[model samples]
Target: MFPKSLFPIALLSIISLGSVSAVDYSETYVGCVPIGTGTSGALYSPSVYIIEDCNFACADAGYTYAYFSNPASSFCSCKNTGPAPGDISSVASGNTNCGSFQATVNALATDYSFQSCYNSPASDDTTSQSTFDSCFERCSTYTNALVAPAGTTYTCLCSNTTPSGTAESCGYDGTFFAYSHTAISSPSLVDRRRRRLERMKRDEQLRLNRFCPGGLQACIVPGSDDSFECIDTSSELESCGGCLYGSYTNSTAPAGVDCSILRGAAFGGATCANGRCEISACREGFQLVDGKCQ
Candidate 1:
């Protein structure tokens, strides 16, 4: 658990597309504050260092913020509300540690070039006549970014469905350009892996629906998160064979009564037979007949 920090957004530095730095992301830098210094950051922690993935993940989750731990920052959450009085402190490394990641991402800068295409959309960052570096940097946030200098109707266009045209020479004048992001694995692959794990968990639970002790059965109590409990109804005093309030298991659930709670049978000596209640003794001044106290 990291110490929870609640500094105002004003204290952070939100980098724009024009900023000449190694790091490029939507969220601002909050210094080199370590994870132990703060509490858990967010629910989405990437196993690998794909800054874009972290940003897209936080944004998709409807969060306004995403943070990184530099070389290996696995924190991304929207918990930054505001700092307490006199709680604003710096981590000493401001954008200095950012270069390590930037250097790795910047290698692709030379690989990207403007292509030739039509129906070009407007620039995502709103600036035009973008050089290769600026265009690539500005379009980093987009999944399928297509950009070129002015005069393509729209300065920049991002379309995941549209296949990029043949790679064309990059220039300031109007010409279509596309980025493949071949440097890293597809972002959707990460989501697929997570979904696969969840499916496996569900499948495992379903498999266990019929597995339990010889006479015991799995039962899901009401209000439980789909979790089931193993119970034996044949001899349980409170529940002879199953739950009393309700049963929500995937298989046919057994319903039984509380053997010790029988009113017709002896209050203190009632016993369960298979799934029925038996009166072994009667209350004081009462005689047992026809399986009831008379």
Candidate 2:
């Protein structure tokens, strides 16, 4: 009864509406219909016919509880909950990647002290006063964002067990930390934390080697006479170039005082006049051989 062109237009409208409905159905993550409920014995009968197909605009705007009826109706709308859309996405303010996380982490400094107890057999004891001291020093400088500096304590209870088990933790250190050694035959929590810290130190050193190589001696030695090889200069030669026990040289030797002839290969063997240390060739009449004064 309708004109040919009108029929085609009507068909197109129906098709468009169907397509829209399909898209609307895919937008919602969940949907349900409640059939009946009573005070004493409430019952919910599932009914797809009463459910609704939501729209992207509704979901995007954070409309959770929704119910649809007639042309368009939403009975329950979802609550707006979840992390802000851009907070953790590529679209975030800084758009920082995982590598950027390291920069932020390195910029921070935290300090924590814990009492470590070693109760292993006197013969198989791996705990040493020197090792603990070194580890404490390392902890003072470990600035990792993944961990906090305060509120952490660890204790190791050791026994002569062949195979080790998972470490347990107990007792709080300060106001924030508590660790227990669970397994009698396993490495204690303190030991595990120590091992983890040691691994981080090694990894950091490896990275330093890749970036600065021979100069990393300063990073490792704490204080060196030569400042050029060190990354961070803390307390005089003790924290920057070399420790009080070490020495460094960047100065060229006088004509007859060839540093290479005295210090040898063990030394970087190059003439350096800048930085904290500067020593030419061998002292007095000693010849530079290998890495020592000959």
TM-score of each: 0.26, 0.19
lDDT of each: 0.42, 0.25
**Candidate maximizing lDDT:** 1
RMSD of each: 18.6, 27.0
Q: For candidate 1, write residues 177-216 as lDDT tens digits.
A: 4553423256675455345435533543443343455666
Error in Å for residue 166 of model 1: 55
Give the TM-score (vs. native) of candidate 2: 0.19
Candidate 2 residue lDDT tens string, 9-85: 23232223354332211221111122110011211111112223222322222232222221122222222221111
At residue 177, what lDDT does model 1 achieve? 44
Task: After the best TM-score superposition of candidate 2, give how far the Cα of residue 217 lies from its true spot, in angstroms.
Answer: 6.9
